[model samples]
Target chain A: MKAITLNSFGGPDAFELRDVPRPAPGAGQVLVRVHATSINPLDYQVRRGDYRDHVPLPAITGHDVSGVVEEVGAGVTAFVPGDEVWYTPRIFDGPGSYAEYHVADESIVGKKPASLSHLEAASLTLVGGTAWEALAVRAQLRAGESILIHGGAGGVGHVAIQVAKAIGARVFTTARSEQFEFVRGLGADVVIDYRNEDHVEVVMRETAGEGVDVIFDTIGGDTLSRAPDVLAQLGRVVTIVDTAQPQNLVQAWGKNASYHFVFTRQNRGKLDELGALVERGQLRPHVGATYSLADIPLAHARLESRDSGLRGKIAIAVVPPAHADARQPRA
Target chain B: MKAITLNSFGGPDAFELRDVPRPAPGAGQVLVRVHATSINPLDYQVRRGDYRDHVPLPAITGHDVSGVVEEVGAGVTAFVPGDEVWYTPRIFDGPGSYAEYHVADESIVGKKPASLSHLEAASLTLVGGTAWEALAVRAQLRAGESILIHGGAGGVGHVAIQVAKAIGARVFTTARSEQFEFVRGLGADVVIDYRNEDHVEVVMRETAGEGVDVIFDTIGGDTLSRAPDVLAQLGRVVTIVDTAQPQNLVQAWGKNASYHFVFTRQNRGKLDELGALVERGQLRPHVGATYSLADIPLAHARLESRDSGLRGKIAIAVVPPAHADARQPRA
Candidate 1:
């Protein structure tokens, strides 16, 4: 099987496309023939040895995939051959979904959404899981409350806007002026241009000086620091980005806000819930740009230089069934 | 009426006895003829003006009181003259309960526990409320879970021992060697001497390396910083003392702990629930010592000296009930 393996951690150029021996499934595991895989910021971090001590070496890059069942190991009764499934591999443990075929525990993987195509299914796994965990699981967002969602146009932010609205929460977003209409189209109640005006002032003034009930910050640093100032009494704030300093404790004591740092773990139950929403047309994935698997270097370069125009996830297309058999992605 | 007042912020000798004008109750208020008021660490902090920004000057020192209702104001229906009540007044917004007659909103006071006398009722208000809020409200301690409570001989810890047992949670406590029997008698499953042995090590060894589900710290400083080390996965740690530095970010995030700092406030619902428990013989107050109303300086002196034998609350008794008259506490 052909796979992208990192011999040493350094840069994007360190990933080598090479031939490797195929892995087989053990008990309670299923072999998946991956059709498509998506990219995430964590993938780049893991590739560069940022989490080297915790995660094992010579790792694969992709964490999420839309794949088909190829084989079932001993005691695996949940899945069968040719069953279409979408999943994220075990967090920092099992081999990732970047290769042609991978084996995973059936308990941590879910059936793919029936409505969306293969690429769309792959795109929804990482960002959708993270956004849902932050808003629903961590914050416990209530209906009829208000939320200030920072980075509302990015991959996770764009999906979060829809999810928060689905849960009946009014959304206040921060982004560039040029993308305000796009963000509003995704159901944001109010949009603040971060470049032109202060987001804290806008949020405070808009919520009648009481601040929002929750703040979801996909962008950390300054945005996370100001989360408490705009938090209502007994409100909560959640951030996905790592803190600026490892020891600088974030205090929201005066406002009675609980600050949570979310590193989204893959939950099969949560993924199944997201799949139901996607099937019902209440949730959808936005793939901003797509490239062939061979053009992964270009995709990585474009993603490293992020800007306002980036609407959703950047994906690596696995030939779309055109160049089959020559180098089958499901090999 | 004669009372002890704080003329300035310095040390224990700053309190002075004086004769002041009596106060009358306003609408929806009750005038209580205070029989006894208990001393708390908060009262000492308020006298030193440490919390001056939150609480103004010229304020009374006490927060916990139990007495007979002398008068009822307009629209006050639940309480009337000759009724017995127990209360902890809101510290900053209202007056303290350390005088001949004190005014409190009807929502903040509750009926006294019929099983105990006035001195016992007064001592139960502060420590009881703190323990209930930390264990029941914040931690939501499950039936089979375990807890590690520090300062088991102090006012808060003594009350917490009974409350944790009442909730069906196993408790491990740390106290002075002399107070070990007292804490164990209050239903502590394991007692460690905080003087010589390390509490965290004892808890770990007892539980076979699995830490407790909740940790209650009445004495902060290094205890708050090291509390996360003794917490199970997804455990909670709540503290009442603010003297600890905020350098425990790593362990807190590592174990995914929910940290809370408790400053017990007057909640009628919570106070009433605790009052019922005391009335039912499920909980009891342990009065460590008693002092006359004129010995306010001596009470403060004893607290500062950290009298080794002190096991519970020290209450100030009203001087010669026949000579006492209705007078509002200084705000």
Candidate 2:
């Protein structure tokens, strides 16, 4: 089987494409023939040795997978051969989804949404679960409340907007002027051009100074520290980005604010919820770029670049589908 | 009317004993002839200019009040003259409760518990509301869960222990070895001497490495930053103490932890809930020291000192009760 292995953590060029032995399913596990996987912030972070202690040398590291079950291990009752599945691999566990074939425990995998293609399902799996957990499970964002999603055109932020809207919440998103139309089309009731406008002032003014009920922070720097300025009484701030610098949060005391720091763990429950939304047409993943399995290093470079003009996830086709769906990205 | 006024932010001696004009009740208000007031951490924080921007100079800055209504203004039907009452003054909105008379909206006042004296009731008001808000409202601490309350012998922590016990939670408190029996009597199931023991190690050992479900942090410095080390997977950390410096919270991301920063606001609902607990003998306030109206400077000095041997609140007798109850502090 062909796989991308990281012998050392440094830059995009560190990922080497080579032939590796295919893994067999253990008990309660299913062997999957990988069709697609996608790039997330965690990918770049891991490739740059941000989590060096967790991933050892010569690791096949990837997170999201949209694949078909090729074989089932002994005691695996949930899945059989040829069933399409989508899931985020258990973080920091054994091998991941960067190879031609992947094996996972049956409990963590979910039936892929019928409406999405392999690339689309792969793009949504990791980011979809993160956005769902941050908004629904942690923040408990309710109906009729207003939510502010920072960097609303990015992978997690884009899905967060849809999830918040699906929960009947009014969405306020921040994006560059060029991406405003893209986010606004995804059910954002109010869109602030972050580079050209002050988001706090715009949100406060738009909501009559009451501020938003919740803030979903996908952008790392200073967002956690400044969340209190635009939060309503008892408002919640959920951040998926782990910041390196310390943050001063004295102002949050006055608002009785809650901050949820999320590094989402893999589970079938959240994936099922996201799939329900996808099936109902309330959610969709926008794949901004596509790459072949060997071109993962190129995808990493594009996603990591500051001026890449990327609006959504970068999908990697491990084994391309026979035909492309309307929602699939153009390679 | 005699009152202790903070003309400037500084040490204890900055307070001036002066005769000021007594406040009158306006529409929807009650004029309270203050029998007692108590010192809260907020008092010292306000005096030290930690919140100088919110508090103006020459302000009367006490928070807890236990007294009798001297008059009621138009549309105020909650109380009549001579009715005993207890409440925390609406924070930063008007003159506080340090003076001979205090005026407050009728909606924020509650009937004093018949079992307590003026000093005892005054000692509990501010701290009780704060503890209730942190545990019951913010953390939503449930029955059969575990909690770690830091500084369990201090003002807010003392009441928090009783509240957690009342909510059927197993309480783990940190205190001096000498105060172990004190916190135990207040229903703490486990007590850790924070001075000598590594709280993280003790908590991990006791809970079998599944840390406490909730942590109530009254002693703040680095507690917020280190909370993740001893928290369960989705545990909550609620802090009342505001740190001046920034905190490194990178470790909190993997735990899916929630941090609630609380500066409690005044409300009658919380007071009523506390009143019910007091009526049922499930809660009691411990008055560690007492001072007369003219001795506020000394009281502040004692409360702020590290070696004062303080156990609970310092009650100020603005107008001492005619007879002392067993729960009342001895002057």
Best by lDDT: 2
- Which window of ten consecutive residues has the lowest lDDT sum in model 1 chain B? B322-331
The deviation in Å at residue A263 for candidate 1 is 3.1
Q: Candidate 1 residues A138-192, lDDT tens each?
A: 7889899999999888888988998998899999999898888878988999999
Give DockQ for candidates 1 onward, in order.
Answer: 0.29, 0.74
Cα displacement (Å) at residue A204, model 1: 2.3
Model 1: per-residue lDDT, tens digit, B1-331? 7667777887877787777777798999988888888888877878888777776556566888888888999999899799888889886776676677788888888998777767777888988998998899877787989999988878889899989988889999988888887888888999999889998899999999999999988887788778778888767777777732645354565565666556556688888889778766778888888777788778877876777788777877763433442432211
Separately for all candidates shown, the number of backbone clashes (residues 3 or more apart, or on different chains) is: 0, 0
Over B265-309, each residue of candidate 2 has an lDDT whose tens digit, in order, gives 879999999999999999999888888888888888888884336
Q: Which pairs in model 2 have colliding backbones?
A: none
* TM-score (all chains, Cα) for each model: 0.90, 0.94
Point to the candidate with the largest TM-score: 2
Candidate 1 Cα outliers beyond 4 Å, as residue runs: A244-251, A295-297, A319-331, B319-331
For model 2, how many clashes? 0
Worst 10 residues of 2 chain A by lDDT: A322-331
